[model samples]
Target: MNEADFAALRGAILALPYVRMLGFDIAREDGVLRGQLPFAERLIGNPLVPALHGGVVAALLHFTAAAQVMREARMARLPRVFTCTIEYLASPDLRDSYASASIVTRTRRFANVRVSAWQPHSGKTIAAATMQFLTGQMD
Candidate 1:
């Protein structure tokens, strides 16, 4: 990510319609892309457990992985996600959630990324995902 435009990336992420609907706050700082999903009634899955919807967590993982792959691979456009395997370690509570992603394997036209999510002060992972994408480029 040499000479990366952190502001532009962040702005692009924030400008996404889904990100806005989910009230996600994302920042690319110090070479890390940190994401926060603020608590909202619409995002709750179960009132008894007071957990966030699994789909929401998946979205965080999916988008995070794609973003990382796009930036690290330096693709002209975001790699199209073809496969994503999500593992729910634990139910995220009804509060702000966070996530980060890293590239696992990247080749000329393929990429894989790993993503982990958690809550502040939880000290335990809530979920994780492995995403595969088509980069459509040859190095």
Candidate 2:
């Protein structure tokens, strides 16, 4: 997509209520997306106990994967997650976490993306995910 088209699509993603509610700020340029996971209390954990919800981590991975597909496809519509698997290397503490999602593969109707979440202090991968997205026809 052209500059104007990409900008419009990015703006549309920023407008989503759920995206805004989750405090996800996703930005893309030159076929790469950088996203920040909000350091909300909901994401922290006790390590010995279940501090981070698996669903929350999955949601973050889903968003990251979708953004990667959108940048690569350069389409107006956001891609949908059809399937995904995540591996938790370690639980993330309360500090800020950053992630980068990249396209692993793409087919006519779908895309495979990999997303890794890291904590700045430890520089360790807290979680890794692979997601498949359904790329429907774009208007």
lDDT leader? 1
Candidate 1 local distance difference test against the native: 0.80
Q: What TM-score, computed on C-alpha atoms, does each candidate reach?
A: 0.87, 0.81
User: What TM-score does structure 2 among the candidates reach?
Assistant: 0.81
Of the candidates shown, which would achieve the greatest TM-score relative to the real structure? 1
Model 2, 1-20: lDDT tens digits are 56676677668677778777
After superposition, the stretches of candidate 2 with alpha carbons farther than 4 Å from their true spots are 1-6, 28-31, 44-50, 137-139
lDDT (C-alpha) at residue 27 in model 2: 62
Q: C-alpha displacement of 114 in model 2, angstroms?
A: 1.3
Which 10 successive residues of model 1 have the least lDDT summed? 1-10
State how far residue 115 of model 2 sits from its true place (Å): 1.3
lDDT of 1 at 80: 83
